[model samples]
Target: MRSAVQIADARANKPGHQIYAGRARAIIERASIALRSSTWVPIATGFIEPVLYLLAFGYGMGTLIGDISTSAGSIDYTVFIAPGLLATSAMNGAIYDSTWNVFFKLNESKLYQGMLATPLGPLDVALGEIIWALFRGLSYSIAFMLITAPLGLVPSWSALLAIPAAVLIAFGFASFGMAITSYFKTYQQMGLIQIVLLPMFLFSGSLYPISVYPDWLEFTIKLLPTWHGIELIRDIWFGVIDFSSFSHLIYFLVMIVLGLFFTTRRLRDLFMR
Candidate 1:
C-alpha cells in the first residue's frame, strides 16, 4: 500500500502535467553539443543554397530583366529578389532542423520521451527545438547579409533589420514544422514536406512578381506563409515599413502561438498519457 501511494504521488508531480519546466535551455545546450559532432556538409549546403540563388537570379537574370517596380518605386532586379531569398534561406534552415531533426528524435531516438521522463515538460522540448532551429536560420541570415552588403546588395542601414525579420520568419516555420512533424511516423511521409516547399518557393513571389498570375492565382499565392515572409522582409529590406508590414508580422505571430499550442498538446497526448 505504501509503495502504491508513493508511486501515485510521483505520477501526480510528473512534468507531464506542466506545460513548461523552464529548462528549455538545457535542450538547446544538448542540441549545440550534438551539432558540434555532426558533419558540416549539411550546414554548408544550407548557407550556400541561397547564395547560389541570389547570384544566379540577381546577377544572371537581372541583366535580362532590368529594373523591377515595387511600392518603393523602380529598383534593381537584384534588390527586389534579395529579401525573398533571405526569407527562403531562413525557411530552409528552420525546416531542416525542425522537420528532419525533430522527426529523428521523436521517432528513431525517442529523445523527447527520455526528456519527459526527467523534469522537462513538452513545452520545454518544443520551445527548445524551435529556438535551436532559429539559431540555424540566424546564422544563414547573417552570413548572407555579410556577403550581400559587401557586394552592394543591401541598400541602407534599415536593410540590416532583415536579419531579425529572417529570424521571425524562421520561428514561424520552425514552430509549424515541428507541430506538423509530430504527426508523421515514417520517412515516406516526410517526403510530402519537400513536395510542398519547392512549389511554395517557386510561386511565392520569390523570383518574380506574383501579379503576372491571374487574380485568383495571386490570391492563392498570397494565402501562403512564404508570401507573407517574403513581403515582410522585402518591406524592411527596402525601408517601406507600413501598416501592411505589421499585418504580416501579426500573421507569423499567430502562427507561432498556434503551432506551440498544438505541439504542446500533441506531445502530452503522445507521451504523457
Candidate 2:
C-alpha cells in the first residue's frame, strides 16, 4: 500500500545510500540561533577557569619555581604552563558542548531524533554538532590567547599557531565525546566523564613534566589525547616546529576520523534504524 513517493524515499534512505544529505549547515544555523539566546555563564566559566589556573599556578607558583626547562629550552614557568592551559581551555569548551549539550539533545530534548526525521542525515547532524563545538573551542582559545599575549606569556608570533592547534584538539575531543555520550542513558553515567577528565587534566603534563612519573606512567600519559594536545600547543607556543609536531598533528587527525566514523554509525543506529 505504499505510495510511489514513499517507496522512492525508502529506496533513497535504504541501508547506506543517504547517510549524509549535505544539510549540516542548517544544523549549524540552528545551533547559532540557540547560542544567541543561551546564557553566557557557561562560556564565561570555561574561559575563567583557565585564566584562574594561569594566575594561581602559572604566576603565583611560577614565581617560586622560576624558569623551567622544556624542549624549547628554559623558559618562565608562566610561559611553559600557558600553552597547556590553552589546550585545556579548548578541551573543556568542546567537551562541554559535545558531551553534555549533545546528551541533553539526544536524551532530553530529543533534538537529534527530530533532526534525523527531516532531510538531515545522521552524518550531517554529527558533523554539524562537532563543528559547532569546534567553534566553542576556537572562541576559548582566542580569548585565552588574547589575555596571555598582553601579559607576555606568549613568547613568539608562532604561538598564534596554538589557536589552530587548539581547534584541532577540540575537534578530536568533541568528535569522540559525542560518540561516547551517545552510549550513556543516565546522569550517573555522565559523572564518569568528569572523573576521567579530571585525572587526565591533572596528569597530562599540564602542571609538571611527565618525566617525573615512572616510565610506565609516563608512557601511559603519552598515550592520552590531552598529552598530545598539550605537547602540540606547547611546541607551537615556543616555536619548536619539528617532525614530532607533525606526529602530534597526525594523532589528532586519526582521532577525528575514528571519532566521526563511530559517531555517525551510532547516530544512524539510534535514529535511522
Candidate 3:
C-alpha cells in the first residue's frame, strides 16, 4: 500500500498523465493563431531571403566563382550552397518558434499551469509545442521547395523527402531550443543562442564549403548536428544520396530524442521550483 501510494504520488508530481488532450488543444490553438495571422508571410519572408542569396550569390556570384568540387562531386557553387541554406532555414525557423514562443508561455503566460489544472503535464506541453514547430516547419519547407523548383535544384522525386527532412530538422532544433529555454529567465538570455547559432550558420559550410575551413574549425563544425543536416540536405539536392544518409538520419533522430528528454526534465524541474 505504501509503495502504491508512493508510485501514485510520483506520477502525480511528474505530469506524465496519459491522453493530454487539453494541453494539445491549447497548443494547437496558439499555433493556429500564428498560422492564420502570418498566413504566407512567414514562408514568403523566410524563403525570399534565402532565394535572394541564391540569386545574387549562387547564380550571380557563384557563376563567377565557378564549379566547386565536393566529395559529392563537382557542382555549381549555387547548387552546393542552396541546400545548406535549407538546413539553416529549418533550424532557424524551428528554433525561433520553440525557444522564444515556448519560453514566453512557460515563464510568462503560465500556460502550462492552466493546462496542468486540466490533467496535462510538462511533456505534453513540450511535445505539443514541437508539433506546432513541425507543422510550421513543413509549411516553410514546402514553400522553399516550390520556390527552388523552378531553379531545377531538386534532384529526384525523392526530393519530396526534403519537406519531412525539414520537419525532422525542426524537431531536433526545437526540442533542444526548448530544453535551453527552461534555464532562461528573460529574453536577454536568448542572445547567447543567437550568438551561438549565427556563428554556426555562418561557419558550418552553409555559405562556403567546410573543406575550405581550417582543419581545427572543420573538426568542431562537424561535431554539430546542423553540419550533418546541412550535408544530408545537400546530398539529396545534389543527387548524392547513398547509404550514408542513414548516418545523418540517425544524427538528427538521436538529437531530437536526447533534446526532448532534457527539455522535459528541465521543464519539470522549473515547474517544481
Candidates in order, TM-scores: namely 0.93, 0.94, 0.85
- Candidate 2 overall Cα lDDT vs. reference? 0.90
In Å, residue 98's CA in model 2 sits off its true spot by: 0.2
Query: Global lDDT of each model?
Result: 0.90, 0.90, 0.75
Worst 10 residues of 1 by lDDT: 1-10
Q: Cα lDDT of model 1 overall?
A: 0.90
Select the stronger candidate by TM-score from 1 and 3. Answer: 1
Model 1 regions lying over 4 Å from their true place: 1-17
Tens digits of per-residue lDDT for model 2 on 210-258? 9899999999999999999999999888888899899999999998988
TM-score of 2: 0.94
Error of 2 at 247 (Å): 1.3
Best candidate, TM-score? 2
Local accuracy of candidate 1 as per-residue lDDT tens digits, 69-165: 8788999999889889989989899988999999999999999999888767899999999999988988988888888898888999989998888
Using lDDT as the measure, name the better of candidate 1 and candidate 3.
1
Clashes (backbone N, CA, C under 3 Å), per candidate, total 0, 0, 0
Ranked candidates, highest TM-score first: 2, 1, 3
> Candidates 2 and 3: which is better by lDDT?
2
